[model samples]
Target: MSTFHPFPRLPIELRLRIWSLTAFPRMIHVKRQCVGDHGEFGLQYMATSTPCPPVVQVCQESRRYAPYRRAFTTGAEPRYIWVNFESDMICNDGSHDLLNLEPHQQDIQRLRLPIDDELAYDYITIHGDQEFKKFTNIKEIHIAVDLQFAGFSIEFLAATVNKCFNGFDNKVKFLDVGSGYMMDANQLRILSDWKNYYSFDTHGRANVDTFEGAIRFMRILDNILTLSEMHAIDDENAKIKQDQQFL
Candidate 1:
């Protein structure tokens, strides 16, 4: 056969395995330049022999028509979706390559996001503002936010999260959010409503009483904090210890 095959004799099941890997990571950090008009860097970076463009072309043919065609003749021609870098703070590429398999909406279960405030804010600005109720299969969301830069009002944030997570798919097991004082009252109020969500606190800060009451928040006791900041809070903690001695 003179015609070149994108994947030679590889089992379709194996191909699916590879496809599943591309969908593997729920949290991705792509630099600003990571995405281009040609293709998202993630997809472009997939193991390829020739230049990037040909790789895509070959992959397109290899993937798109194969999976869905075998599944059912009625499906549409496969579209290659990518979670490319749309901006500085977000990884725009997620399941783009898997779409090449011509499957309907994909389902990814775990999301552990390790990002900065800029990206976190950017993510909230893009995806958080709305309810992601459709991603029903999503079971966990871990966000490491830089409270210094992430500008969120408490009530707004709490309400937003409640609206998104309070759905029927309460399978969400853990929510790790490390944010700061930059959050306004509106944001705090919103998060406080999620009193029942599990693993509410991995850090000691959740015990601090805010205007929102004893918040089942996610924070730590500054184990990761810099020495200077720890010293600042240490004085306050010392005063509390002294008061307890009198009692």
Candidate 2:
């Protein structure tokens, strides 16, 4: 009776609830740093606490709460794995991260691919396909691509996607495609063709021909573009203010 343990005295359900809250999932942006001295790549900025979770640091009885462990085990939110395919020799090596996932982490369900013009296809053919084959539990794939930069023919992209998802039959679910660059009539038609071929559930689809659904996509795009412009303007104004302060 020497110790004062108010938290332990609480009901078991309340204690579990408190532990789960401490391990809430946050949006994490992953970037690959250069090859290390051992020539092995390393991840730089994954959004997780430096040490362990506070609850885990508690006594053994608190550690027995499995939900606390499961929640904090994954760096990214469950059901959404993000990969940046932009060609930046400095900070864009997400392809490498996807390739090197541990066996337990390989069973990802949803993927968000953000690709630029250069090296998109090359990266997909080599690294992406390899990862996809390993992702036997993959369910949905979301893409935001710059087709204009790579000058990728519609046929080429379709073939690449098919190849990447070759191993999984119905396990591969919806394809949510959006574009950073403007798409022409022909390009839109190509997406339509792919949708028809896959016959995916459009309830989870975006930027597709379904007029009602497309409206939702357009609204989201508009908000993103607007926010981007606002941020740029804010940065410019801040710079000017700083310069004036110096004067």
Q: Relative to the true structure, how large is the alpha-carbon lDDT of every model?
A: 0.37, 0.46
Per-residue C-alpha lDDT of model 2 across residues 162-211, encoded as one tens digit per residue: 66655543333222234224332223444546455543466663235442
Query: Clashes in each model (backbone N, CA, C under 3 Å)?
Result: 21, 0
Per-candidate TM-scores read 0.33, 0.44
Candidate 1, superposed: residue stretches over 4 Å from native: 1-105, 129-134, 166-169, 172-247
lDDT of 2: 0.46
lDDT for position 16 in model 2 = 79
* Top candidate (TM-score): 2
lDDT per residue as tens, model 1, 76-156: 232223331111112222222211211211243344343344544445545642434444355444433333344443333
**Model 2, residue pairs in steric clash:** none
Best by lDDT: 2
